[model samples]
Target: MNIEKARFNMIEQQIRPWNVLDKDILDMLIVVKRENYFPQDQKTLAFFDTELPLPDGSKAMSPKLEARIVQELGLKKQESVLLIGAASGYLAALLAHMSSHVTVLETSLALKELAEKNLAADGVRNVSVLLADGLSGQHTGSYDVIVIAGAVEAVPETLKKQLNVGGRLLAIVGRLPVMQAELITRSADAAYDTRSVFDTVVAAAPGAVPSSQFKF
Candidate 1:
């Protein structure tokens, strides 16, 4: 396959048409070499407009989705990020380039190792991969940005509370047929503002269970 041509097509045909217009983000898509984050068997799917399946039964966000989420967050270089669901660590690597630092939480140990290996191999120094339950919201230090890397039935308040004042969070919320990408901002006085950005669907984030599993 002509790697550079495929990447250009992915940016022009897939990412750009999806409304990911940020030049920095578009450039990062080129710089990051998405294929490097995929396992050997899945490398061919790297530039395709689809989610790559991970070993833990979770899916990585499509390239367009990843770009859109980063563009929507309007990340600044000085901010810190906490990313939930470190599927292969690709998203965290993307986040790292846009922010000062990134801390990624993953429930699967193998995936945590894979993410670390991929990021380290790519020389992504600003990201830290940790084996932790993102749904538990423990050990997730406050940050200026938080990304729930997959779909969820709902955005838990515990995760919302971890946001620093003026921080922003991006999450894909709802059920399988369709889900809305929502951006939440932390305002003063412990308040939050949320607005739906777009609609799409992907696999539920690792560790996210049906709402019925919780007791009242």
Candidate 2:
């Protein structure tokens, strides 16, 4: 396959059309080499407009969604970031380039090792991968930006507390068929403002608590 051509097509056809217009972000997509994070067998699907399956039963977010999340967060060069559901570390790799430091939380040990290996091979030294349950809300430190790499029924309050004042979070919220991609910003110690950015559905983060169906 013509690698450069395929990559360009992915940006023009999948990512750009999804409203990802930031020149820096579009350029980063070119630099990041999404194929590098894919398993050997799945490398061919790197630029496809679909979620690629990972060894841990989780799925990589589509190229467009990933770009959108990055653009919406509007990260700064000196800010710290926390990424929930690290998966293959592709998103962390992207975040690392634009932030001072990035920490990824994943529950799967195999995935943690895979992420570390991929990030190291790519020379992304600013990111760290942790093997821990993201939904547990037991993390340490505060972050200037938080990105949940997958969908959840709702953004737990515990997770929100980890954000520094003026910090921003991006997540896909709601159930299947449709979900809202929302950006939440912590304006004060206990005040947050949320705005729906778009609508899309992706795989739920593994270990995310499902919303109770039966109302008592």
Candidate 3:
């Protein structure tokens, strides 16, 4: 199959109808080359809007899901961002284009290294790949934006705390049919506000912190 035609179909048929209308993001998708992030065996299926398998049995979030979250984060050109579950650094690369600085945290050593290599090859200097359990929060400074590549049963408390007063986070919450893609923001009032962006499911990060039984 022709890769360009497939990409155009993905952007037009799958992503665009999902409310990913920003021309810049659409253009970035075209330039970033998703196939480069996929395992060679699966490269031909890169733009199929389906999760691609990883060595650890985990999976990359689908193109549509990625588009939805990227669209929801609404990154700015002069903002520092934190990314959880940096698989192959594709999302981080996308964020690097729109944000000033990005810190990508990944639990898997192999994935972290893979991300670093890909980001460097792409000249995405604004992103740093860190080995850490991103679910619990690893940084101290205020971040203007955060994007979690994997779905979680609940948003970690510290991740919420890490956001600056006006920072925003895009993550998927819940399980199965109840799974919802959400955008959480630390409002100026020092309160968190959340809104569902769409319905989707993605593999939970390998070492994601599980919420307490009481957390909803």
Candidate 4:
């Protein structure tokens, strides 16, 4: 396969048409060698418009979805990011390029090691992968951005509080056939604004909790 051609095709065909028009983000997609982060057997699917399987059985978000998330988050070079689910470290690498630092949380040891190996091999020094349950809401320190790389029933309030006053969070929320991709911005000490970016269904993050039975 012509690697560069394939990569370009992915950007033009899959990512660009999906409304990922940010030039910095589009350039980052080219700079971040995604095939390097894929599991050995899945390298061929790196640029395909599908969620690639990870060693831990979790799914890496598709190319377009990943691009959209990054665009919506609008990461700044001075910002710090907390990324949940280090499936392949691809997203972390992308976040690292757009932010000053990235702390990735993962519950799967296999995935943690894989992420570390990939990030190091790619010389992505700004990312740190931690083997921990990210959904537990026990993460230390505040962040300018938080990304839940999988579908969840809802974003926990505790997790929301971990964001700095002007932080932004991207999470795929809902269950089953369809889900909404939401971008939440912390506007003030106790106020937050959420906007639904798009709707798509992806795999769920490990240990992701569902919404309660009762409804208002």
Candidate 5:
């Protein structure tokens, strides 16, 4: 395969059309080789518009979705970021380039190791991969940005509390078949404002089970 051509096609045909118009983000996608984050067997699917399956039964969000999420975050060079559901560290690798520091929380120990390996191989030095349940929301220190790498039925309040004032949290919320990607910002006086950015469905982060629905 013509690697550069394929990359360009992915940007033009897939990502750009998904409303990911940020030039910096588009450039970053070119710089960070998505194929490097995938396992050998799945490398061919790197630029395809589909979620790639991971060993832990999780799925990496499509390239367009990943780019859209990053673009929506509007990250600054000095902001600290927390990434839930690290998966194979592709998103963390991307976030590391745009933020001062990044901490990735993963539920699977094997996946954590895989993430560390991939990040290190890519020379991503600003990220720390930790083995922790993403749904638990137990961690030290607050962050200027938090990105949940997958969908959840709802954004737990515990996770919202971990964001610093003026910080933003991005996540896909709702059930299967449809979901809304939302950006929630924390303001002074402990208030939060949420705005729906787009509608799409992706696999739920491990441990982020949907809340039970009551029947009439």
Candidate 6:
């Protein structure tokens, strides 16, 4: 693949239409080489506009979805981050470039292994990959930013609590075909304020505990 041209096309065609515009975030998407993170046999599918299968019952979010979320994080070099649903560590690798440290929580042991191998392959060093149920929001430590790679009925209160005061968590909330990417920020009163960034859809976390409204 002519990586540079493909990268440019990916950003301009796939991600820009999705509303990702930060030049730095755009540049990072090119530099990180998404194809490098995919299985060798599946490298050609890296830039497609659909989710790619992963180990366990999981799927990597489409390239555009991943770019959109990373762009929305508005990461800072001084901040630590939490990433739910590490998938194959591709998104985790991208997060590592923009944060001081990243703790990725995965629910599937199979995906945890894929993430470990992919992260290692990419030489991403500051990420701690662990297998944990994201809806439960188990933590290794607090973070200045939390980026959940999948959608859920709602952001777990536990994950919200893991954010430092003034920290932000980016996630997809609400039901299919109607979900929106939301940014939740911590307020002085220890409450959270959320707003929609863009409309999107991805596979929900495997073990995400849905809200009562989702139960039938």
Off by over 4 Å in 3: 209-216
Please give the RMSD to the true structure for each candidate, in Å: 1.1, 1.6, 2.3, 2.0, 2.0, 2.1
User: Candidate 1 on 1-94: residue-level lDDT in tens?
Assistant: 8889999999999999999998999999989989999978887789898877788777788999998999999999999999988887788889
RMSD of model 4, in Å? 2.0
lDDT of 6 by residue, 1-216 (tens): 776777777778888887787888888897888998787787877888878888675688888888778888788999999888878788888889999999888778888888888888888899998878766645546889998787788788888988898889998888767888899998754789889998877778757765764556
Question: Can you tell me which runs of candidate 6 are displaced by over 4 Å?
Answer: 212-216
Model 6 has how many clashing residue pairs? 0
Error of 1 at 204 (Å): 0.9
Q: Which pairs clash (backbone N, Cα, C closer than 3 Å) in model 5?
A: none
Off by over 4 Å in 4: 212-216
lDDT of each model, Cα atoms only? 0.89, 0.90, 0.82, 0.90, 0.89, 0.83
Q: Each model's TM-score, in the order given?
A: 0.96, 0.96, 0.92, 0.95, 0.95, 0.92
Residue 100 accuracy (lDDT) in model 4: 99
Clashes of 1: 0
lDDT of 2 at 125: 99
- Model 5 residue runs over 4 Å out of place are 213-216
Q: What residue pairs clash in candidate 4, if any at all?
A: none
Model 5 poorest 10 in a row by lDDT: 207-216
Kindly list the per-residue Cα lDDT of model 4 for residues 1-216, writing each as its tens digit: 888999999999999999999999999999999999986677878989998877777778899988888999988999999999998899999999999999999999999999999999999999989988888777767999999988899898988999999999999999999899999999999999999999999888766866675356
- State each candidate's clash count: 0, 0, 0, 0, 0, 0
Cα lDDT tens digits, model 3, 106-211, are 8888888888888887778899888888876555556999887877888887888889888998888887667888899899756999998788777776466556
